[model samples]
Target chain A: MAQQTNNFSNWISQQIEADTTFTLSDAVRSPSRSRLAEGIFPTRKDEEWRYTPLGQILESSPDMDSRSAVTPEFINKLKDAMPQAHTLVFINGQYSENFSDNQTHLENAGLRISRFSQLNSTQLQMVEETILNAALTDDNIFQHITLGLAQNGLFIELAQNVDTQTTLHIIHISSAQGDTSFTNPVQVVRCGENSHLKMVEQFTSLGQAAVITVPASYIQMDKGAGLVHYKIGIENNETNHVSNTSVRVAESGTYQSHQYLLGSKLTRSNLEVSFTGPDGHAVLRGIYLGDENQHLDMRTYMDHAHPHCSSDQHFRGILNGHARGVFNGMVLVRKDAQKTDAQQTNKNLLLSRDARVDTKPQLEIFADDVKCAHGATIGELDPDALFYLQSRGIGKKDAALMLTRAFAAEISQEIELISLQDYLQDKIAASLNEIVNASI
Target chain B: MLSIKNLQVSVEDKPILKGLNLEVKAGEIHAIMGPNGSGKSTLAHVLSGREGYRVDAGTAYYKGLNLLEMAPEIRAREGMFLAFQYPIEIPGVNNTSFLKKALNEIRKHNGEEELDAIDFLSLIKKQMNLVEMKENLLRRPVNQGFSGGEKKRNEILQMAVLNPTLAILDETDSGLDIDALRIVAGGVNKLRSADNAFVVITHYQRLLDYIVPDFVHVLSDGQIIKSGTKELALELEERGYDWLVDKAETQA
Candidate 1:
């Protein structure tokens, strides 16, 4: 097992050594480089990765030289999901200026959107400070890998009191044909005081591409600032995706995140949020729907280090065929964090006998005047509900579809974007149609 | 319009309905009154094609077609409706959309063009008025957070919308107050026509006071022991079911 772990680390180290296009400064890369030098990867014995197996990702090689072409029509098809938003496209981790909208307009509006390669000295210093100050309690080796070797990413900064009505949509398309390709994209968002920003990050592939995507994001919210962030993953069946995101909220700041993991052979998402000052709030909602031989894992950590802060999290999973899902969440209230309110809920629905889910919701409260509650449930569709629909003139398959859609609608309806909500609902329905047809 | 002969049924290896027989034509209402565990609900469930019921030896025919061989949805599409005693509370399913889908499915099955959104809303509004149902109920999930009376009214609302040929009321008056019962019975009376039939199943004869039944039958131990006009309900109500049960046992 130790030998296998070394080989996986060595594979990543060799890719970093072979890449000549690496652009980050040595100061930003040295810490991760020293950590990666240990040449260790998580094994099944590790508590953090007990349920997620890294065999497929370790066995495949990421060919850096191979690149797949993407057509304009394909990008347009994705752009239709949010037509009113300003769009940016990335193919194989490299930003495409030809496809992205002009950034001069946004710059004029006091929103600075700069690529990592184009970051000025002050912006680069801000990125380094945000990374250094992140209070992540569950940092892992994959995060170090993305940090050490990433060459493509974005740094978005909004000036004080600048709230834009338009949303920022970033699209990442992984299209690798000859061999398994790897791409790591890091994003950092710095919201100034009294400002608000809405951004969406979408990851999708071109056809059935073999790839491994490792992405990381760091967000910093100043006092009285608000950030609405959305991350959507709809990659192909042969893709393996792992992501890490850390957030820090200051006083009176608000952070809301919605993650929809819809496709991929194997996916593991680790998210951590910490309250840096009192009166901060965070809301997290997500859904992971898997089918066939897919495996999906979601892990979250809420750190309430200040007083008078609150966090609410609700996540749901739907698995069919031989899919496996995992939800491991923890909410921590420090001794000094008085009057903290935290609630966590995770619910899962299994459509087939072979499908499985392992959920663990935990709360650790140290303050005496705190309200913390957590709950987890895993079950199949209600048989009585199915019969009721069938007795009302709906066919068996259609009845199953209706109940399953309703299960997801509870969360999808909470999305503030109507177009995105409808798009996700339609996608969920299409996937459920396949599962119902195959099983029934 | 409906016929049954020796309709014996069992649930989980226990016989619930043994040799039950009934017959009804168009433009008629039959009331099946019995005590608890007398197979009133079993008959209704078996007729509606609910699962977990085994047909030991019997047959049910609707319009000369075998009802036992059809699925629940197929039976529903063929104009058979059953108003549940305890309606299901299905969260997240919108009431209006569910009814619209059911209506469209039945219409499509009968080779009728599906109703558009506007037409469906208009029809549902008219049916809601006929049933005196609150308009707010249409915006909530089906039967979720509904009061007992509201659930019964929703069933009647659905019945009015679907417009079935043969409808079965399975203890629809079990938990209703006097006013709710009157309103429900009034909805049924308004929907009754020469082309439709109703089979009202209740433990008491109070429901029969409003929706007068043309035929009343005593169901004791799963079989029809007595058959008469609506006045039989009045006799059974005054004397109770024990006398009728004793008379049937002596006759056996």
Candidate 2:
């Protein structure tokens, strides 16, 4: 495992030297940059990353940014199906105007979606002089250097009382003629007071053995305003992508985020949503499926900073083969945050004896008047239930699928968006398809 | 028909059944009334192949096949049913789906075609009337948040749908009220047939009042100490299990 992770990092760094879009300044070439890179790939020393050994994943893994050389047909299909979101296309971490437009809905007033490196000094000052600076710091040593060396991503904002629906799709296609490389793209979203917005960001890699590191933050959502952010990271075994999400929910406002992690060799996502308002609420929902030796780690913190605010966190995963999964949901209710209602639940199903899951549903409450509950369970298929199904004529594989589906059905029921819910159901069907076909 | 020969069982390293034995032919309703700690429910669990209880000695044959040789589900598929004394509650798992899978598993095991959604729904509706169970209970998860009486009725409802040939009702009448007892007993009576058998394990004679037994026996100390007609239950009901315990003690 150590050798595999070493080989993967070496291959990724070499690809960086060869790729034009992955260019980095001298600041990005330090030991600190490599340390931040370590945060994405877990080490044996990390507690939350216990079950999934990042070393093992890197050993046999492909590059994280090895997306395919695009075909015209693929481009056409993407343009047709892509929602009219404030779309931003990033090809190997470089802007692609042929697939983007900044003049989106409600963005004419104090809103800009462009390359981060292209921002003026005033914009750079705004990025420096912001409340997000406290929470979005590069705590991981390597991430600090990467942030210093990185350039060019996305910058979005929602002016006070301005309602907008901008869909941003970051299509990351790997170069056809190169080794698997790495690209750290940082995107920021801000919503002013009394404003409303919905954004969907998607990341996909096309090719074999590509690795991409996404270190991004959204200083979005203001008092009396609402934001719904959806992130769908779907990459094949050819890529290992890691993303960090920091969300800020203001008083009387709402921040909702959903993550669908279905692809990647080794995927680690750190999501932190802080409810710093009276009566503010944050909802974090995610679904991650791991097959083979695929490892997906999720560490979330729903910090209630203000009184009467609430947060709901739910993450469920399915593991097959020797696949491993980790979910650490921390619901922290600070002192004086009375009347707060916080709930966190993480459930997993291990399809094989070798499949493993480590889930810690943690709740830290200092307020006595608050209500918080957390639960986590890891178990194999119920034998009596399985026997009950098989005796009725269902095949063993079908029976296993039924049990796993039943476990995840409760979470799927929570998705209010019909199309998204339908999409998830279809994905689950595809997972079971192999089971049915395997019998033949 | 079910037959047990020199059946011996133990639970948690404690011997419960020591060379105990009984037989029930098709169409026969055999009632086994035992004193406390007499291994009656243990026999039911062991017969159904429930985990934990180990069979130290004995061979149980259900229609010439080794009953203990099969898994719990295969035994269920093979027409052997054990209505648990305390039915397990599984929330988030629907009653309709659980029963459908169970029925279909038995069908599939018998090499029958699997029922589609429409057919399965209609079959569930038909069985709902047989047990007088509300269609709503069938919609909920198995035994989840159900009242005591409702749980018993649901168990009988499953039995009606699965159509088991040999049912060992292990004190299904304990938690039920009088009305619930009547409804459940009525369902069991309706399912009784010339080709099916029953072993009703109970403490009180009240359950026998609803579904009268063909034969009654007093089980004491892991073995049947006395056997007689249905009249024995009435006598024992008039005189508690202590009288039988004393008789067994004197005989020993």
DockQ of each: 0.82, 0.24
Model 1 stretches with alpha carbons more than 4 Å out: A1-7, A19-27
Report the C-alpha lDDT of model 2 over A339-417, residue by residue, as the tens digit. Answer: 9999888888777777788888888889889988889888777776664454433456766676677666666666655
Model 2 residue A74 CA deviation (Å) reads 6.5
**Where is model 2 more than 4 Å wrong at Cα?**
A1-67, A70-134, A141-151, A155-178, A192-207, A317-321, A348-362, A366-368, A378-399, A426-440, B249-252
Q: How well is candidate 1 docked (DockQ)?
A: 0.82
The model with the greatest DockQ is 1
Model 1 agreement with the true structure over A223-264: per-residue lDDT tens digits:
989998888999999999999999999999999999999999
